[model samples]
Target: MDARDRDGPDRDGREADFTWGQARDFANQLIQAHSGKHLTDLEIKVLQGSWQNHTYEAMAEQYTYGAGYLNRDVGNALWKKLSQALGEKVSKTNFREALRRAWWQQGRSVPSVPPSVPPSVRPSVLPMTPPLPAVPLAETPFAEGPVAPQSPFYVVRSQVEDLGLRSLLKPGALVRVKAPSLMGKTSFLYYLLQGVQLQGYATIYLDLGSIDRDILTDLGKLLRWLCARVSRQLKIPNRLEEFWDSDIFGSNDNCTAYFEEYLLQEVPQPVVLGLDNVDRLFPHGAVVEDFFGLLRSWHERARISTLWQQLRLVLMHSTDVYIPLDYNQSPFNTGVPIELVEFSPDQIQALALLHHCSLDRPALAQLMAAIGGHPYLVRRALYELGTGSQTLGQLLATAATETGIYGAHLRRQWLLLQQNPALWQALIQVVQGTEPVSLSPLTLYKLHSMGLIHRHNNRVMPRCTVYRDYFRSMHRADSP
Candidate 1:
């Protein structure tokens, strides 16, 4: 067989097994050369899935995106772009045939397609993410699982409260989120990240709490590890050797330059890097200061350079306590600071309803009085109540006791306080007093940082009745 005859079936066979990697390459070249626009990751996913005789529903299942979004939004936009490039109308339904004909006219292979069922005969499929079976909404408590951004249990009354986080998607725009633990800071960050996911952005969620103590103990290694991990999460090949210049440039500068030159180039769209548990770095004096300084510079760089704008930051920390970096060099002092407080009574009621609790307004208010609308505690109480594992009265009664519903949580806090006797004693004075007590600034900072005390002006008090009652009993019974 001559070259033309020999190549026909082989080209058709390759089309039958056509995959995402192939479609992405061709679509990228075509669109970039024609319209100067590159196909997004989700768009490429849609293209290959569509070419394989997959309907939007099937493609959505494969891509873990909404079918309507895939069909009405991405699919329509994609076909429009292809039509503009190919100079003919193209669509998901006849994509293979159209592509074949187009390729024929252009003297290219017909990337035909695999044998597959027609759209009419296609069975409904579930997404790659396993979903809970349909049940009474309340019985499937929102507290029992990772709350989706759209989950009814996850409440957001207004966008104004989020400090434009949802809308501030530009590169280098930094959002500093501060809240005591369990105040829904992470959940709020998740809401923000989910918003970007719908807009075809890449996001990385790194909890510094997950960082190894070994790395945290040293500055140089920590920065290298962080750069490596962020690169890995972005699916970009790490070129640490090319970026690191520890002997000449400082570690922070090297890390910053790496992201600017190598890392940012690999990302197709804007990036949202979420640094959770920022307090984890607070103990490492020099490292924390320099690292935050680097972050501050990154945010500032966005103001001047267009490329730096692709690196938006959302930093979440659990305390007001900060390492004393120059005010100008600390990302904490600038940028939008979002402080998440406990849920309000109305929010608590909404949560209860979402949890399927049969609580009246008075009962919810009573629970709010007992737990002060703390997200984790409120959700825990509602979960147990909704599941019939505990009554509201039963929860309230045990909440302050060592063996109560919050036993593990309370114990963890108490243990942390025990490690710092000064903090423990200051908490004692705050807990036992009729009103707020004055403590040393560092002591007060520590207590507030633990989410165990409320600080205002120069005085401190137990954060809630649960903390007061539990610690008051412990303080009175223990050695003076």
Candidate 2:
């Protein structure tokens, strides 16, 4: 055959099977060039498994992702991006040949992934061993707020934690942490901020939930609150009057100047500012646009300005931003987005052991069957068990009742639902249905944010058996 014909598929047929590693490197370059975003670890696993012809179910078993998430969420988005990059249709079934053709067209057989920098040559972004203090398992506390930095009960969420840390190390990084309430967003935020602080980066954490309603409604007051908080956290005097001139500069500009002129300059090291419960301001349309727009502008400024590069933002929220935003002016579109998921059975068991509440495999399974590895719920159960307040059986029996350990929590959720009839009805449909029920995006977002439901794609179900049973019983009690 001619040399030209030899470079075609017939040549690939005679060669060894294309290694997933090489395909991974090839696709990473292509996708990054096309989308300006690198493949995530989960996305990499999906690509690797597909290249090996492994089913999504098998991949899920071998990896941390769920089969449905692998198939529906990650896989669908990946294929579309690959199709755009390769200039042809790409799916799990046909990706192998498509990649092979692209491989030959590029005229390179070897992987193009860059070599890792040696420790000596690498930038000193993080310490080799971060000084994370250890808490004796027996002395670990069951605190209500974020887990202490030294707590042994803090179960390291390997994937999400690694991603967040790596993103923060980059100059001018923006890391968005989104999860339902009480799913340990605050706990994870503390863990992350502690890591950066130990690295010698100046860290400031502010929870927007603590901001008053009047301040949230007024742009100037909100900006002033933010400026004052950052200054106080940095041990600097409250100089909002010095930097902020509301009459001359707009609220956004005033906030930016406060950071650019004072906060960033005052801190000798890189500044990592984490804002928690950012969604608290979502209700005020005017504030949401201007505040988030300021954030987006700072992120963009980091790309070229050296002073702005010193600032990195970490935003922690419990739900999606439902309001409209300018496409070019929203920080959400850029930056590393993280969604905290429920814990695995293994993590739950490890935490139980830390609490010194040893239970057999079957007992642990029973607990998960009721609560499904919710971080706070699991911690609370283990805490109660550790305190000798209730037996495993007793806890399970009364879990859905008002007298149970989760009584206050369940009541708060019920109160929230009562305040919104539409949200209440939406959750009712999900709770009563045997299968996942569909709801409007806003309703689903609110329910998920409240930790009342779990969404698998467009459909949602009661987040746990506790919610399902509690809501169902409440409905029955109200029936005539």
Candidate 3:
């Protein structure tokens, strides 16, 4: 008997034979076959949540886990594993369709055809493709937070990573990774920390961006928080009281003594401390100088003190260091500076292929022309295209519109600009002007850090065609 005889399309004339329970079972089977292990409880929650179109934040609220841990750490690995098992690209947004196609391919159910259609003209549930080699669709996991160290989607900039690792291994090393927002600076640091760990070093990765504003403003609280976090990562007992004395020592001195007497001494191997989004502290005028100056002191001491040499620092930030400090007290100028640049065309092609998007040279060129090899933007485009949801032409056609794949990101940039009239006007000039526009140094830095415009020498232009087109259209619409 034909599958259509048992299960037919719903009233809407679309197939309704597939269900979420069936999807879960199919996923379980594929995952078990691939990993020889069953899904965890949290994994099931994510699977169910994704099936219901629930965002990671929603899942976290419902299930009581950190959204970052669920999305970046768990969701990233889960989708990649599922993609590998299914031999097709899978993500939270597209997994439903992917599973439906897979189920239909397994002869589970045929899509119900309309009786009006001719007997010989019935369509298959999905288009058939050639039996090609399985792509590492897992490598191209969803581009959330920082790209996981295990992801193949990470494109290494030329020799920059090697320089970072080399610098990280040196005694008293200070490696600074600076890039505009979404340029993969954090992802690079993730990989760098992994590499350092493999070399018998104790590694601690912290994202200062997530620190609370209240703690940020208080020097004493911030120092204690930093020490407590480091101790936790190192699995050592927190002894801040024994080392900290407000009347006897300044916050910086207390922080130093805690590290020198406690953290540095507890670990047998050298320690590589990775501080991501360190610029988060920049707004706290009182805390920023003392904290950074302390780091500078540590780096200087490392030159002569073996105990201090055991500590290596990796600071990653998305902005220029505009805060003033005495020349000898600043840590920014003395390190191996690794500034991440936008992905090159070849690099973008490599990442696209990882996402199973075998875009041809011309198609790749078209994408580059629109987005200019921005890592996050390029990955997002490939992800959408790989899902078989839209053609390259369709994506590019809707690229600058609010309904397109990049709509949320574009809207976020717009909202941020709208909050600051000066930044808003500055961006307008860059987007509308035929030649590169000159702006104040601070204004230029802010725009560049926001990833809205590219800086060439001292002049600026809209980062890419997408920004140029979207902002230009918005400017026109907002005008008389």
- Cα TM-score per model: 0.65, 0.67, 0.68
Candidate 2, residues 179-224, lDDT tens digits: the string is 7678888988987887777567899999999888999999888988
lDDT of 3 by residue, 245-357 (tens): 99978999899989998889888899999999987877666678888888889999998999999999999886533323222332347778888888876566556655677
lDDT of 2: 0.76
Residue 169 miss distance in model 1 (angstroms): 2.5
> In angstroms, what RMSD does candidate 2 have relative to the true structure?
16.3
The models' CA-based lDDT, in order, is 0.70, 0.76, 0.77
Q: Where is the poorest 10-residue window by lDDT in model 2?
A: 124-133
lDDT of 2 at 195: 75
Model 3: how large is the Cα RMSD against the reference? 15.9
The candidate maximizing TM-score is 3
Residue 170 error for model 1, in Å? 4.2
